[model samples]
Target: MSSTLTVTGGAPLKGSVAVRGAKNFVTKAMVASLLGETTSRLRNVPDISDVAVVRGLLELHGVRVSEGAEDGELVLDPADVEVAAVADIDAHAGSSRIPVLFCGPLVHRLGEAFIPDLGGCRIGDRPINYHLDVLRQFGAVVDKRPSGIALSAPRRLRGTRISLPYPSVGTTEQVLLTAVRAEGVTELRNAAVEPEVLDLIAVLQKMGSIISVDTDRVIRIEGVDSLTGYEHRALPDRIEAASWGAAALATGGDVYVEGARQPDMMTFLNTFRKIGGAFDVDDSGIRFMHPGGPLRSIALETDVHPGFMTDWQQPLVVALTQAQGLSILHETVYENRLGFTDALVRMGATIQVYRECLGSTPCRFGAQDFRHSAVVSGPTRLQGADITVPDLRGGFSQLIAALAADGTSRVHGIDLIDRGYEHFAEKLAALGAQAVRDEEPARV
Candidate 1:
């Protein structure tokens, strides 16, 4: 597929598109297969690049990966798990940050593990200090090499108590993947309780790990000596579902997102209603639509689970551009998330970014210099312009903006959307979006 997409806008998108397993949960669950003694089966997996990266990394470590009888099913066998060559692992460097997650599971199967430098979306500060610190607490020796960081377990890894300064999803995943097989019990405070994290805990439980979650942000895991393989179906990608929902609202269309569960999108549903969007939920999926009336502006703040997700804000920002009056979006999760609004501004939306915390509650970024707050003044008519996709979610937001605008737009860097959103271009076509892959080469 070409990297550029030419989109003709100003039409409502109406139809249904199915969403599969979450990119966030599926990748980690694939990594968890390394801890099992037998083959594991995972279902509802999506055809995303991130999953392919993890599968390749797993194969490099000698895990046999194959398809199951059903579509979107993967059978992973780690019976021959071994150390991958440093050079081979180096080839995957900067492709994804998932490689760093291989540290604990690899150190368990092989006495030592080497991980190339990690790379992910250029969102904000995602330091690996928390991951390294938690690993060191589990008795793993960390050696920083030029090519990548090497970790070794001199003795059996022991469980330790940990309290994260914030409820970071990645750090919490690192702790869980490491603590599941460590000796004794591991208690983690201030952990992320996102649906994806809970789903991962469910996967671990199926694999014979004793895990408990409290009402508060506390998790305790009892280590077991051995684990057998598991048969599990991953949760649907709520981010992708919400992105489509936002797209529907932005274009004044109706979209039925199959596999979108109501339980996972309560907060977003409430916000969607507040912004004059309507949804009908059934067992199979949810249908998101813009009510006939004007879109209402809202005050939203991005937070962890049960709060407005940071990932949900970008595409919704496009919807906000057509809403009546002013809308305030204070991004408390990633500092640079609001930077995507600049593209919306270039497309003729009225948006202003600020460093001050615009939400009711002051957040960690309040004192920082990062422009994490955005105030959108809208009911402005959007005109299409040439756009360059930035990151995954941001790229999807730009696509929504282009579809909502008048005239034509040529969107570059569209491949980035494939990293998280599964077959999005095809889905857009299924939804009646007037977009086609550009046959000509993308501009340098």
Candidate 2:
């Protein structure tokens, strides 16, 4: 059995919806609080399940988290940080990869850290090897067990040089969180400069750490002996904002997304414009709408920061289904990202996934047998169908498909959608879509 949403199609989702913190940064910022000797205040936090999950994990480890002076604010105090029971740690962190981030702060504060089995979206192969290897470079010894991995600093962790084979966002985060309080200066090459990472750096700076980022992708962090509290505002979630923008384009709707920063979405905005979508930018937010014309097609490829993000690719594919010609996308970031297109195909979208790279330059997965490229032919009228939600971004793409199709569409497994999107169903209702709830029996 699963929770389902029945959506009536052909209605534009026109209205304003608010977006809070970037989930990528807020969760890590919460983990950074474990390094502080005093209370840390994080504002503009979103009411997402990931935030709640991280808060629970922090509370489990004796970190105190409470509401701040305003709504969407969190006060995290690390005064009582301690090692938690392994079973409780396992239970609290069920399938979340966040526990891996606790290693650096815990090793500095308590000399040891235990990470339960890690989990995240089933997008691709996300291994903790990069994280573990980085920790080892910092003098932490790692021991593997059945339940999880245990890490201990035989001596105080010391800063070391690191060069990543790729600019993986997760590994870069692990390095930044751990390097801040290490014994000496640490240099990281080929680091990720995504906006979320930069915002996390801002949070750490407010907490009394010295870090530098160079245009050549080199980040140097000087370890400080001690740190205090911080009061900082989190960057708004650009992924969520882009998701709604793609939705407006797909349904021919007008959407005003409050708190969406234009600088963070320049790549996506440029691509949106090339596809014939119209947008207006203002100080408060950006508004995306259809200009009542036939949408043009585009050639797009997902890449690292400052390129089209893999997270943005999934939702935007929904809009491509309505374009006038062929839209080709080379998903260079994640090999299995195109898996979600299967559900879109079921919903009457003419999308084909390929193994070889379809762009000018072949990416890492080009030679691999993974389906990493897609060609979508559109101006095709979509119809309603029964679909199952795949992952977080994919789930939203499914929702867009359902909203754009004619007649009623039944979508199952929306609990996956709740992981990142906050009150999405309510937001959809507010946007004038005829979306309603329905319960279903078991699939097997």
Candidate 3:
């Protein structure tokens, strides 16, 4: 049976919580360990289901994953890495999209890699075609079966020039993982340079890969003949930090998210300030809260990198419901991320979804007739309602709405949030939010 959360709303949440390594970067870095000649130590690892999923996949491929020198650290030994049976991989893979990332490292080491049917959040058309295309460009053969895809590199995989249709983070990561081991120089155009991607690049550099980033969204990598394991700390999760900042705004409370860095979150920080939310950043972390005043509404847009992140828009939308006027948001990264706002509408939020682009940016989805724009009319007093968790970010967005509403709210399918957010219920309690697991049946 699935777990649910019963939340009593209309209370302010205050206090502090710590964020660890990013779920996006840490998982990819674990896959990168496969290319190492020795053991790799990854620090600041968060306790999230996605990390466990990656660990399971690594162990299945004969990599030894163990505890590091201290807590929130992982030691990955790729010295004895060997190919495992297909059934073993599928059995351990579960419903994770991480297996697709293993294609490059596995092919480079064992010359063949089998991928299980990949699954992740139902965000949008996040296809593996781009990854497969990149692999094929690097002289890898792709074969599709009922179970999953199999990739084989018959000859020494050599680097090739590639250009992405969009600046996709996953595809860019796949190329980085593959190109670092190829025989020659690889150039990528229209590449995504998200901070998480840069952290992965740093991990690769620590392992002896020579990569250069050009100013015009171009990345060049010179494959090294060999690589050693790396000892490095992963970057903190900016998405999680921004979610908590939005929580502080939605609940009209103060929250100090320790370990949140400013450089990576500059875009989000500036946007949060324009909304009339208060924040203070130091060397440790950022403290976010709502000052007693009228919250102003503003037009916002989500983009790839160096722009407002699409992941940050969900929870921030909950906070926008408390703003004095309408706030328009254009989601360019993912077309369907705004679908989660329907539950908010059920909880007395005034949100209208439109096919046209609503914000300042003209995105590719503008002409595609997708419901990519949302106009939030707010300062609406939200009431409690039963809701189901949709995806990772959306699940947290649901929790924010439930906490901002009056009375109690029953939230089901909350286990999905474990995929990203670490120890969220504990963090909520520490913040003085009345959120508890509902062991009993729901009240109808």
Mark the 10 consecutive residues where model 1 has the least summed lDDT: 435-444
Model 2 whole-model lDDT (C-alpha atoms): 0.92
For 153-177, candidate 3 gives per-residue lDDT tens digits of 8898999999999999999999999
lDDT order of candidates, best first? 3, 1, 2
Q: Number of the top candidate by lDDT?
A: 3
For candidate 2, the C-alpha RMSD (Å) to the true structure equals 1.3
Model 1 over residues 1-444: C-alpha lDDT tens digits?
348889999999999999999999999999999999999999999999899999999999999999999999999999999989999888865668998789989888888888787888888988899999999999999999898799999998999999999999999999999899999999999999999999999999999999999998999999889898999999999999999999999999999999999999999999999999999999999999997889999999999988989999999999999999999989988988877778889889999999998888558898889999989998988999999888999999999999999999999888888899999889999999889885556456
Error of 2 at 334 (Å): 1.0
Q: Looking at candidate 1, what is the lDDT of residue 384?
A: 90
User: Between prediction 1 and prediction 3, which has the larger lDDT?
Assistant: 3
Instruction: Give the C-alpha lDDT of model 3.
Output: 0.93
After superposition, the stretches of candidate 2 with alpha carbons farther than 4 Å from their true spots are: 438-444
- Per-prediction RMSD in angstroms? 1.3, 1.3, 1.8
TM-scores of the models, in the order given: 0.98, 0.98, 0.98
The C-alpha stretches of model 1 lying farther than 4 A from their native spots are: 439-444
Tell me the whole-model lDDT of each prediction, alpha carbons only. Answer: 0.92, 0.92, 0.93
